[model samples]
Each structure stands twice: as C-alpha cells, then as structure tokens.
Target: MAAQKNAGDKDTEEKKKEKVLRRPPEEEIIIRGGKGASIRRKEIGPESEVPSGTGKVAGGNAPANGEALAVHKEVAVKVDHLSMKFNLSQEKLDSLKEWFIKFLKRDIKYDEFWALKDINFTLYKGERLGILGLNGAGKSTLLKAIAGVYKPTEGSVYRKGVLAPLLELGAGFDMQYTARENIYLYGAVLGYSKEFIDSKFDEIIKFSELQKFIDVPLKNYSSGMKTRLGFAICTAVDPDILILDEVLSVGDAKFRKKSEKKITSMFSSDVTVLFVSHSLAQVRRICDKAMILDHGKLLAYGDVEEIADRYEEMTEK
Candidate 1:
C-alpha cells in the first residue's frame, strides 16, 4: 500500500509538471486600432537597459550617458528596450508523430533568432521618424511589433493615440467577397464603426475607382485594385499615429501620387509618423529624424541628413 501511494504521488507530480510546461504564455495586450481609437495606459517603469555601444548619434544630438533626456515635449510614441525573438526549429520533422517523438525525447533543437534587440526610442507629436535598414535588418519586424501585430519577446511600446497601420495592405480581405462587401468587413477589422464606415463608403469607393466593379468578387479584382481599396479605407479618417511600411507605391503611378499626397497632407496636422522606405532621398524628404538598424540592433539614430549620408556609405560598402 505504501509503495502504491508513493507511485501515485510521483505520477501526479509528473502530470502537474507536464501541465505547467504545456500552458501557454500570457496573452499580449494589443492597443487600439483605426482612426480615433483611444490609447491604452501602461504603468511607466524605469528606462530599460540599452545594449552595449548603442545610443550614439551623429552631430552630438543624442543625450550623453547619465544625462537626462530633455523631454518637455509631449511624447507620441515610446519604445522601451524592445526585443523580438523567434525560435526556429533546427530540423524539420516529417509528421506530427515524428515531432512528438522528438519532443518527448528532448531531441528537438532550436535556433534563437533575435529579430530586434534592445531597441529604444521616443517620438514627439508631429515628428516623422524614418527607419532605414538593409534587407533582413528587422525594419518590418520592428514596425509590426509597434503595430501590435506581433508581441514583443521583451519590453514594450507605448503610444498616445489612435494608430493606422498601412502594413500589408489588403491582407485581411476575403477573396470570395465582393469589393462592396469587403469594404465593410475590412473597415470593421480596423476598429471603425458601421455608421462611420457607412459615411465613408462612397468616398472609399470613389477613391479606389472601382465603381463599375464594386459588385465584383475580390478574387476577380487585380492585386493593384485590392491594394488601392485597402489604402483608401485606411486613410479615410485622420489618425493620431500613422505607420507606413513600403506602401507608397500601391497602384499605378497616378494612384501612387494620389496616395502619397494623401499621406503628405496628414503631416500638416499634429499626427506622428513612422515611415520605412528604401529610397534614401524619400526618407530625407519625409523625415526630420532617422535611425538605422543592423543585424537586429540599432546602429545609428539622429538627424535625417546624417543618417541618410550614413546609409549611403553603408550601401556603398
């Protein structure tokens, strides 16, 4: 009887351990979306530790070590010690049985891919920050993290107001639905109300220039047409913060100019902008401040012209 009880206790303990191991991590809280969404509040904590050799800027614009950053201006966005990590499997198992066997045997290995590491920055209201990086430097990953599409592995991003993310335009559209149907569906996905969408419905259709084909299924619409519609819906209302990821050239040259004009018109307001563009000249034109990322780490951040010059040097190398 004593031996049986001990065995049962051991089994129960093992089951408890398994349950603990199988439990998922905490769900990441996504902030508000779309135009006029209220910002969520997070308790501000001490500044996060910066990685070694970071926080340097050209022209001596950055605050010195141990020097308090002068921040009298209202902050629009703050990214604190932000890090994004992914566990890439070392080997590909053919089936679920094989994967389970490997998992039970503790034979599965993973490669830790740090997409963004120890990134820190702050943007004031009405400032445009251009993000510059080579391919795979984690520019898009950083933007996604800020947009709350991907939860950070460490740290946090705080924003003051509504955010309109123009990343992966038309990503949420239903291919089987008509353009008219998708306008309402996609609008709700962005946190807009039916009443709000109803008011902007015609404007969105007019801007997309899909009047004749509004009743046609989205599956039949060309990729460019879908992109134009997505752009029109997202930009229908002015947002407090706008995140742009390689979306300047959405459709034909004419539509592209129209879209660019719409974005530029927002700058005259007090909205904060985070822009990522491969064109150095475009970044210089659209941003007053800039930052560069190399190998998932912040390399340089400061005045736009200096960073553009540095980016040119990096490209030449």
Candidate 2:
C-alpha cells in the first residue's frame, strides 16, 4: 500500500510540473505615438489565467490592428469654383501719319472669351471622376486650372494634396536632349525631386519598353514612342491626385490598352483621378461619376449613367 501511495504521489508531482511548463511568459505590448491611441490584443483562452504585466485582451468593439496601418487613412482632393478667361485685343498700328490719325480718333476694340466659367468639383480619394465633352467644351482648360498651370481669372482653385498632371504628351521635354536627360528635366518641372527621378528611372524605362533608345535624343523619337515614354514617366511616381487630359489617345492601340491598365491599377490605390476623355464609352467603364461641359459651362454633373444619359439627350436635341 505504501508503494502504491508513493507511485500516486509521483504522478501528482508530474501533473503539477506539466501545468507549470505549459504556462506562457507575461507579454507586454507598447504602442508608439503618431497614430491615434488604442492598441489591440488577441484574446487568451478562458482556461488560462493572464499574469501581471500583461495587457488585457481587447474587446470586440475595438478596431483591428490592421486598421492602424497608413493605408487605412482617408484623403480627399477639393477643387472649388475655378474659372478662366482670355482677353483678345484688336489694335492696328499704321504708318506714322495714320498712327497720329488713329490717336486722334481714339478707337480700340477688345473681346473677352471665357474658357471655363465657375467650375466646381471635389474628388475624394479612390474616386475616378471623368470629365467628358466635345472639342471646344473647355475640358482641357479645366484640367490645366486644376493642375495650377493656368490661374483662374474669376474664381479660386484649392487642391488639398499632391497633384500629378498628364496634360500633354511631352509638355516639358526638350527635343535636343537625350531621353534620360529629358526625364530628369520633366520630372523636375513636375515638382519631383532629383532623388525620386533617379530611383524611378529604371522602372520608367522598363514600362516604356524603350531601353534600347533611351540614349537617343527625344527629337529622333517617333510621336508614339515619345508618348509612351512621357506616359510612363508621368505615372511612375504615384501622386495623391492625378489629372489626365486626353493623353491616353496619343499612343497606339496596344500602348493605349497598357496605359488603361496602368491607370486602373492606380485607381485601385488611394489615388484620386480626374480624367478628361472624348470616348464616352471608356468614361462609362472607368468612372463612377461624370461631369458634362458644353461651351465653357457645366451642363450636368452627377451619377455616371445619369449624366451620360442627359449628355446624350442634349446632344440629340
């Protein structure tokens, strides 16, 4: 009986040792400042007792730990009441005698042309807003205003974040310079640091598929080739806000498809896109909302389908 009791005592001791060995060490989680308060922890099993120095498990109402990531933050771009106008003057300078005669007559003619009149819109992050209109509908002008290239004549334009504009195929490119040199120059003109351009150089070249001709001067490049390079460079540095003005039409069919895919990928990120296109079908496919402009005036702005239907109705009338 004593031998059996001794064996039972040994078994009890082993059970106590196993319980001690299975216990986890006390865990302390420290959250650094910068992001808002609230650190989350996973729940422990009910059978296990939490030790001192360990934080309490977060409740179900608490946000997930992934919510603290930077990508979860929201951003927006606002463009308020932007308008532009150009003044044209008609003045004739004649011979010395005629100039004196005209001075005596004191005649002058001036005309005011409004390019964009009281344009207003806001683009929240991750939104793809399409601007559609006819040839002289001020679509390009509105894009330039938003890009800060053209100051408004009457109203104000306010953008909340960084803006990347692809207004022209090669707006700042120097024909005399090599493609590599032009890349730096254009990047600088677009407000990118030299360091950024250097880092993105290889990616830009790869995307353009022009590594073979990157050493050649831009003047020697075909229009389509130049367009490809320009598009690649413009898109390499993802900006908070992106403006595109009829630039997608510059390349061939295949390149255009590639550009479209690139743009789609960008939209998937936190980028806000303001796109101007003459292709109504393409606009319908890519845009959740659309604005219709006619002769420097906003005819309609709302849901993509509703605006498109209204625009078609106006055109048919």
Candidate 3:
C-alpha cells in the first residue's frame, strides 16, 4: 500500500512540472488573422494614439469605494430638455405696403409652432448616432439646434471641442470667386487658418478630383462639383464632432461613394458624429446608436438596428 501511494504522488509531481512548462505569463492567446496568436503586449484602448483594442464603454465620474460605475473621460454633446419654438404668420399679406401698414399697427398675427420640444440626449466621444424620422418630423430641427443654427427656446446645450457641421451644401461659399479662391475663403469661414488651408490644399483638390476646374468660377460649377469641393474641405480637418444632414444625397453616385468612404474612415477614428439620413440601410451600416423622432417628439432611442426595425413599423402604419 505504501508503494502504491508513492507512485501516485510521483505521477502528480510530473503533471505539475509539465504544466509549468506550458504557455508563459507574457504570452496570451488572442484571435488574430482568423486564428489565435500569442501576443506579448497589452492592446491599446480606443482613445489611444494607436488603437489596438476595442473601445470600452467608459464609466461615469466619482464612484464610491468598491462600486462599479461607467465613466467616460469626455462628452461630445449633452442636450438637456431642449425645445425650439418658431412663430409662423397665420395670414399672408398681399404686398409690402400692406405688411408695413400691419407692422405699424402691431396687428401681424402668428401661430405658435414648436419644432422641437423637451428633446434630450447625450453623445459620448467617439460615438456615432443616427437620427431617424420622416420629413417634417423635427429631425432637421434637432440637428440644426446642435449645429447652433437655431437657438433653443428652452433648456440648454453643452459641448466640447471643435464642431464640423455639413448641414447644407455651399453654405459659406462665395459663388463669385473661383473654386481655387473659394477653397481658402470657405476654409477660413469654416474656422481654418490660411496656413492650415494651404497645407490641406493639395489633398482637398485631389479628393474632389477638380484639378482641371480649380480656377473656374464657383458659380459656373455644377451642383455636383460644389458638393464635392465642400465635402473635401469639411472632412480635411479631423473634427472632434461632425454633424451631417442629408448633405450626401445631393451629389452623383460616384461622389456619394467617395463621401461614404470618407465618413466610414472617420467612424474608425475618435470622432463623435450626429447623422441624419432617410436611408435606414446607411444608418444601420454606420451608426452605433439611433434616435427616432415623430412630430417633435422622441419615439425611440436605442440601438441602431432595433430603432430601424421600430421606425419601419411606425412608418408602415
């Protein structure tokens, strides 16, 4: 019996030694190239200069001891109980003479219109949100509010870092100037310095593929050319937050494809985005989350794919 016990103990010792000879502490099994590869170093986080790992949902600030909490280091946008109000004239005057007479008498009447009411949402850094709604459903109003085009009638909006809004095609452009001159002018309007625009000049012109018409006056340029130029300049700067509102639908298919590629590339980067599009497929393809609004009211706000499903149901009825 003693000999049998000794043999069993020796067998256990050999197994322990074999275990120690296996994989080292420095090497970890990670899936790479469709197979597990031993990696020696920790993967970098999303906000890192060189991203090597997926982004963790950063937790909230100031947690009690032993308490688990979500805390992100930064917030791109926070909309708190926001509302937008506009007054539309109930009656139209026939001529300027009649309008002046009514204005002098203080008799112009309007109906109260609330484009947005008590809308609230928070956008985190490096998060992409898609806004879904039918026409006149206040999607544009919400985006415009965030873009600072329209002031909120109620609540407040807080934001950090530079905002690059592509709300309209050629909004700040000078039609009289040549496309080359307009590049600098529009860049300055977008808050870029002359030197900065100078540096991005070649890249912008190359992406727009408008080298031959660079010196042509912008007014003579077709809508597609204008859109291409505008898109190139806006995307040149790696903006902290980007707001796009149906801007891509204007250009031709090829230009649209190029624009889509640029946007998709930005999605991989650390850029917070607010996108409004009628295409549900595009929303699902790009957005991390989605929000649905109907007649100035928020219907649903959650995962992109789920929201797409709900939106389809809502619209079908």
Top TM-score hit: 1
**Model 2 residue pairs with clashes:** none
Give lDDT tens digits, candidate 2, residues 1-317. 11112232455356445533222211111111122422222221121212221121112111233433323333244444556777765655546776678778885456788888776554545767789788889999888776666766765444434566787886568899999998888888776777778878999999999999989998999988888888998897766678888877778889989999998888876687888987788888888778888889876666677878877787788
TM-score of 2: 0.71
Q: Model 1, 5: alpha-carbon shift in Å?
A: 54
Provide the global lDDT of candidate 2 against the true structure. 0.67
The positional error of residue 248 in candidate 1, measured at the CA in angstroms, is 0.6
TM-score of candidate 3 versus the correct structure, residues matched by position: 0.76
Report the Cα lDDT for candidate 1.
Answer: 0.76
Error of 2 at 293 (Å): 0.9
Pairs that clash in candidate 3: 58-71, 59-70, 59-71, 59-72, 60-70, 60-71
Write out the backbone clash pairs for model 1: none
TM-score of each: 0.79, 0.71, 0.76
